[model samples]
Target chain A: MSWLLDNFTLVTELALQHARLSAVPIVVGLLASISLGWLAHRVRAARLIVLTSFSLIFTVPSLALFVLLPLVLNTRVLDERNVIAAMSLYAIATMLRGAVDGFDHLSPGVTRSATALGYSPTGLFWKVQLPLAGPVLLANLRVVSASTVSLVSVGALIGKGGLGYLFTNGFQRNHPTEIVVGIVAVLLLALSFDVVLVLVGRAALPWIRNLGGTSPT
Target chain B: MIEFVGVTKTYDGGAPAVDNFSLRLAPRRITALVGSSGCGKTTLLRMINRMVDPTVGRVEIDGEDIAGRRPVGLRRGIGYVPQDSGLLPHRRVIDNISVVPLLNGATRAAARLRASELMAVVGLDPALAHRYPAQLSGGQRQRVAVARALAGNPNILLMDEPFGAVDPIVRADLQQETLRLQHELRKTIVLVTHDIDEAFLLGDEVVVLRPGAQVAQHGTPADILADPADSFVAAFIGSARGKRRLTISAQRSVDGADRVVVDAGGYPVGVIAAPEGRLPVADPTPRSRGAQVVG
Candidate 1:
């Protein structure tokens, strides 16, 4: 704790980097997941292929992936791109499942109603199907973001991770306080992102507030 | 001005869903298609808006073949009320009601105004406009669906089992509201239902269909009831249809009350005799609204 105060600037900077590193993968993964999910929903065989491939990709150990990504992408072992690339794979793996589940949870009769009402295909997809999918997608955002935050700490094993460096550094220098600070910081960051995602979801969809006023999470 | 001339539909080389169906529906009148499940009652209704196309014949609206019209354009002018209300659960009541008009190019303000007006017209309170469908009771949601269907002031309304989801009391209320709306608006309505009583009560003409979509009988309620075409029609009306077998005599009320008596299934049996032949109560069918009981 004393070392953390002594190097508060260092801690804050690394924490910011950690947040950025985690957030990038989540954003990239969300876009890719949405596209894949849409395709899977429309194509009969795409769901099977996507689910199987994503499951296999997710099973790659994080340490191995962090090391293996640099070789695959032709980057340096210490370059931050290596960590981001690996974390994005994890993020996409997580979010694809969430997106598929969200789509499945849609109200059954809404599609039939929209068609009978004469909604154009584009209009139905954007105005009705996508907006109605807000709750499920929001739930996915929280899960993917939190997991990404946790996994960002794992990158520190390679000396390129954000918060995980504090752990390795504190141990090398016999600074238990710094280690505690790093643990506390990562937990707090994950919690903050979860709350933020929830707030964003609520602001975008006010209709969800009246669903018994309970947490959809 | 809807005409179905020799319209037939079959799915995947199977038995015809609607076999050689032909009919003409006069403007501004309610025609009911009633039958058991798989009788193509729904298929017949769907053919109007081009949801299901005829395999062997063309359907015409106002002397124009609907096959030539774009489906989306044809559907926009025809209001549809599907079974189970089919309200969009994520949307508020007002947004659901206004969706059609908004899609049809009405400004948001104009659409919302029309939505509120329709809310009142469909017997829904204005306050419910901002509530999501999940927060509403089933009956309230059904009214919201009706409001949505009416938002565009459509010339034709296709109601597919519109009142099938509600309880008996709410069903009665909705039916009364529908009748009042029909009388006031005079829009052409095609109501599809399996309930024979609902068909008799609401339809200007009822078309009965068999399992294969063959027309069993087609006529007014009085026409079918007064003289059944065959035993199949008679049994379809009711198993204990004693009116065709027994003669009903008017007897004085035992309690000396001015009322008509009925047998078990609500058939009018006799009326209380007027004192000293002043005249028995004239009619048994309650002409007032919402007096509907099982036939």
Candidate 2:
């Protein structure tokens, strides 16, 4: 307990750095996934290809993906950027899956009705499809965010900044308190992001709450 | 006015859904396309607004061929309502209704104002405008869909089984509401349904399609009942002709003399005269023997 109180400031700083690392990659990954997913949906023939490629990327072992990035990019001295890249790759897989799921989840009747109502393809995607996909998109965001928070630890192997750094440092120094603090902080961050996502979904997408009160998967 | 000139649609690797169909939908009148499942009634309806383009022939609206026009522009001028309501789940009732107007360049406020008026036009309570589709009942959702179709105030409205997902009572109410709207608005309408009774009730001209999307018959309800083009239509009209006859008889009243009182069984229970001031009691037995009317 004394150990915890003494290193509270150091732990808090590490936690913040970890959150930033997770957040940056998640944001980038989400944007890319949504854009790519929407493109795949608009082009009927590209759906299978886009989905398969993303699925394959997701199947690659996380450690292997991170390890290979430096080799592929022809760079050494893995730093914060390596952490971001590794976390972002992980997030891309989840977000792409989520975006595809959101697109497929839309009722065909709605698309038909939109077309019948004279909505152009663009209008239908923007006004009908995207808005309808909100809950699913938000849920995807939560999953990706949680995954990034946990996976950011892979950065410690390459000497990057985050709570993962604290874990590695504590392991080398034989301090269990630092490792426990890092693990607990990450779990709390993931849970908090999930709760915040739910609240945002409920507030911004009241239809989701009204539709059987089941959050999007 | 909408004209279909030999329109044919063949799904990929499948038989033609609509086979060289040709028909005209007169302005300000309701035309019902009735057929069995996969009979291409829906495919035919979609061609009116170019939701599904014809592979062989052309569809015209207001005497202009819609082939060269951008499908989006063409659709913007035609109101479409489909079965299952098809309201955007995330949008409030009012926003859903305003979709077309917004597409047509109406300001958000203007479109919203029009949407509210349409909500009333379709017989929905004004308070429902703020509710999302998920919050509404099936019947209410269908009403909202109708209201949305009317938002652009287009001269042509196409509905494909718009009331199919609702209960019978709600379906009847929606049909009545559609008729009332037609009376007030006088837009050209084409509706598709599998139910012949619905076609009779709603259509000024009923076109019956066969299994492969061939047109079996096209005529007024009275004419179709009096003389069906073939046995397919006869069977399709079902054994409920007696009830349909009563409805037709009631609608055809001149000087209010066609008095027909039908029981819940749809059999004539009594006959009375109002414009002729004659009240006569007919046989109360159900008319199960023949198609002829007894006075």
Candidate 3:
């Protein structure tokens, strides 16, 4: 408690950085995944290849991939960009399959109706397909967000992971307080994001609020 | 004017679904294409908007070949109602009804206003417009589909068994609603159904198709009834099932009025009032909805 009080400014700074590190990757990764997922849905054989590639990337040891990305991108090992880019890649890997499933989750009957009613291809995607898939994607979003928050700590291994070096400092100094604080911070972040996601999802799909057998929850 | 000139559609070199079929759909009238399942009635209906293209024929609307037009543009001018209603589960009823108008550049407020009018035309309550499709009953959803189709104020409305999915009571209600709508809007309507009675009830002209889109006979309901083309036509219309043999011989109670027609065995087969030395003119007092009357 004394340590936190004494280092209040540092704690708040690190927490803010940690939140940014977690959130930016999620946003970037979701944008990338949405595009990639749509391509997978539109093109034959693209789904299998994209999903398989993302799965393979996910299987690679996080530290090894973290170490390897800097050399490939020609950036310094400890640069924040390295952590952000690597975390985004991880987020994309985790979310790509689920994103594709979100699109496939659209009802065939609805799609046929849209086409029959003179919805142009672009119009259908914007009005019907994307909004219809929003709820399912939101469920996947909460899961991916929690995972990203935890994974942001992995960047501390390379001296960039936010709130993660607290555990290291705890280990080195034989102090349990720092480790507990770190776990509490990450858990709090993840939980808050899950609630925000639910709220945003409800706003995005007002029709689903009263709909049953539609929401996964 | 919509004409199918020698239209033939085959699936991937397989046998023809609609083989060298041709017909003219009269303007602003209901023409029903009725047959059993797989008789290409649906395929023929879909060709109007180019949802299904005929392999070897030209479908023309107002002397313009439909194949030459952009499908989206072509379809926007034609209203379509499918068997299952196909209302988008995620959209509100008003949004579903306003889709066609929205696609055609109507402002949101304008589109919604038109949609409300269509809802009334289709016998749906304006209050239900804010509800999602899942919240409504099956019959209400079906009515919503009709409202949606009519929202564009389309010159032509194509219905592919629009009432097939609802209960018989709802089906009868929808049929009456359609009749009322036809009386007002008078749009060119092409209806597809397997139920012969439904075909005759609503169709100004009924084209009976056989397997492979063969036209067994095409005529008015009365023409088919008074003079069947063949045994196949007779069976298809259920004329051979003692339905045609029915004579206006007996009487039974109808709607608290003492005018109802009974069959040869004194059972109330229908209600018809034949004035002395005159043909039967069905007494046109609006009977209760869903009551079946035959002649």
**Most accurate candidate by TM-score:** 3
Ranking, TM-score, top scorer first: 3, 1, 2
Q: Pairs clashing in candidate 3?
A: A155-A161, A156-A161
Kept native contacts, as fractions per model, are 0.49, 0.75, 0.52
Between 2 and 3, whose lDDT is larger?
A: 3
Question: Candidate 3's residue-wise lDDT over B5-82, tens digit each?
Answer: 999999999899999998988788889999999999999998999988999999999998999999998899899999
Error of 2 at A104 (Å): 1.6
Q: Which stretches in model 1 have alpha-carbon errors above 4 Å?
A: A71-74, A212-217, B243-251, B254-259, B264-295
Q: What is the lDDT of residue B160 in candidate 3?
A: 91
Better of 1 and 3 by lDDT: 3
Which one wins on DockQ?
2
In CAPRI terms, where does candidate 2 land? medium
For model 3 the local lDDT of residue B32 reads 94
For all candidates listed, what's the TM-score of chain B alone?
0.88, 0.83, 0.89
Question: Interface RMSD values for the candidates, listed in order?
Answer: 4.8, 5.2, 4.9
Candidate with better DockQ, 1 vs 2 = 2
